[model samples]
Target: MSIVISNPPYNMKWQHPFFAQSQSRFDLGLPPENNANFAFVLSALDHSEKATFILPNAVLYTSNKDEFIVKKNLVDKNYLEAVISLPGNMFESTSIPTCILVFNKRKSHSYTQVIDLKGKETKEIRDQRGQYGKTNTNRVYKKELNVLSNDVIKEVLSVIESRKNEVGFTKSVSINDIKEQEYDLNPGKYIDTESVDNIHRPYEDIIKDLNRIIESKNGVKITINEKMAKDLEIYDLMQDFKQSKELNKNMNEMLKAVNPNLKIKKEDIAALSRNKEMKFEVKNFERVPEMIALFISMWKQFVMTLNNEENRLLVELRDALLPDLISGDIDVSQNEYDAKEDK
Candidate 1:
């Protein structure tokens, strides 16, 4: 045959590719054991002067050991005439991205033409996942699908015929240029795209935003969260502190009444309670030191726990801001740092 054209079953496995390694059809190399895509290409080319096949885009640049060797050999032999990349969702059964491979035994050009047709489609219907196709009226794929409009088809034919370079669409790449790309044939790999740079804001502004995240929410009044219930542990601790202090006061008065020169050491209390309804009496003045010792130890630990929580918040704030500041992403220059310190 002089010309052969086909769209074979994509990515299908074949046992013959593994066993028929000696066949001339695989003169380049055997296709990967997992898929018969390249096997179909080679077989079609064996019987004809020119063969064109629709295959999944993976054949263009897949790095599987066996398949890559075959691809490299194909490029080296200059069997490839042109590769045209088609958009994904072209098939009803699978949305696998596909491409057209045109191979010729008798060639006119040494360079291979690569065309990308991703953004050419003007009308496209998206599939609705997780919906029953028959039952759901809203399921788009059941009624319509993406297709190549006549204009897009004409555009592709023109690009192929012209074999001309169009920015972001097509290019005629030489074997040496393809080698520089390390045997990659994906059309997008050859397209040049615009780079977007990040805009860095003032460090203080970013810090304020980060602080809001760290805080989780705006602060509220203490009375809103405070419990009205009397049996709470905090209430008991407050009462114990108060009663002990009052008892100590009464005991001191009693001891001083016996002798004006007598005095005792006082334990300092940072947090105190005043309950006017409670009456004071000395049940056992001797036990007052032990009572103060126990309550003061508990109170000190409670204060320490609150302090530790504050320290943790400080650590977290530093962690959140430090990396961005150091990397110059937030731009906390020496001047900015000094200004923040003044603030």
Candidate 2:
């Protein structure tokens, strides 16, 4: 045989019978069983004087032990001549994409040619006569080439003869650069598909979008003390009312203790009055005001986030009733409610 052409048995890398045999020759272990396609490739590379093998696209750029050894063996000796990457759906019965790899032991040319034969249909007429076979399906069948298009094959042959570098679509990469990419033989990685252009977005528009996203983000804590202002005012008012009531109660008590017959008039009393146990007097008025003010200040300090037990209880009650209040679910008209409702 001028050229030995063979399609070996399909076996995965890990489980294949040839893998054990091949590893000993190449001194590299088999690729993972998930992909044994490379094992066949290695076997072909080792055995054939010159070879053309169809392998699944994975064998081109694998970095595993089998792949590393295969690449080192091929490129170190400059065995690989041409690698043609084909398109998907080339194999209709199966979905695996294939590539045509041409290898040679002797150096025919300085540069390697890569041809892309993807995305093209190949057709062959079964019969020249407009007659059907014995099976009664009366149409002449068209058989397509399993591998390369005529145009692609022609280009490949031409490139092999030319031995010159072609850029953009086809690349004749040097052995040194292939070594730099860690022996990765992927054609798409080498080919630059992007077109150059100056594209810029407006700064104002970008800022506006960023601000919108920031505002849309939920659960961000804001340091705004809205309730603090209103609460402080209410606390001051309550403090004044409490102090006035205590003063009025004390004055009434003191009057009664000083003169038993002297009746304290309701009109003379302050607007707020409370019957407290402590004796009320004008002498204690200043002290009462200071104590009430201090209590109000302490209450202000306590008005922060309700993280304590009492504060937690208050918050729970508020939250529990809030939904019902907002949804108008509870009937406030029911007057049977008493102190027991607190329980």
By TM-score, who's the top model here? 1
Scored against the true structure, residue 6 in model 2 reaches a CA lDDT of 51
In model 1, where is the ten-residue run with the lowest total lDDT?
217-226
Candidate no. 1 TM-score: 0.52
Q: Over the stretch 1-343, how does candidate 1's per-residue lDDT look in tens digits?
A: 5798999865665676444768888888888654677888888888898989997666776766888888888888888888898764466444335689888777777788888886675545555443332355443434234478998878877876777898878888888888989898887767654443433334343333333222211111011111321332344444444454454344334333333343222222223223323222223332233223323223233223222222333344445445555666544232221122112
lDDT of each: 0.57, 0.46
Model 2 poorest ten-residue lDDT run: 215-224
- Model 2 agreement with the true structure over 1-343: per-residue lDDT tens digits: 2353554433232565653654554544455554555566666656666777776555665545756676666776777777777654344222234577777777665455666554344543333223332344555444333445678667778876665455445677667767777776666546544453322223233223222222211111112133443443443433443353344343334333323343212211112223322211222221233223323332222222111212222233344444554666544443232323222
Q: Could you tell me the lDDT of residue 133 within candidate 1?
A: 22
The residue pairs that clash in candidate 1, if any, are none
TM-score of each: 0.52, 0.44
Can you give the lDDT of residue 207 in candidate 2?
28
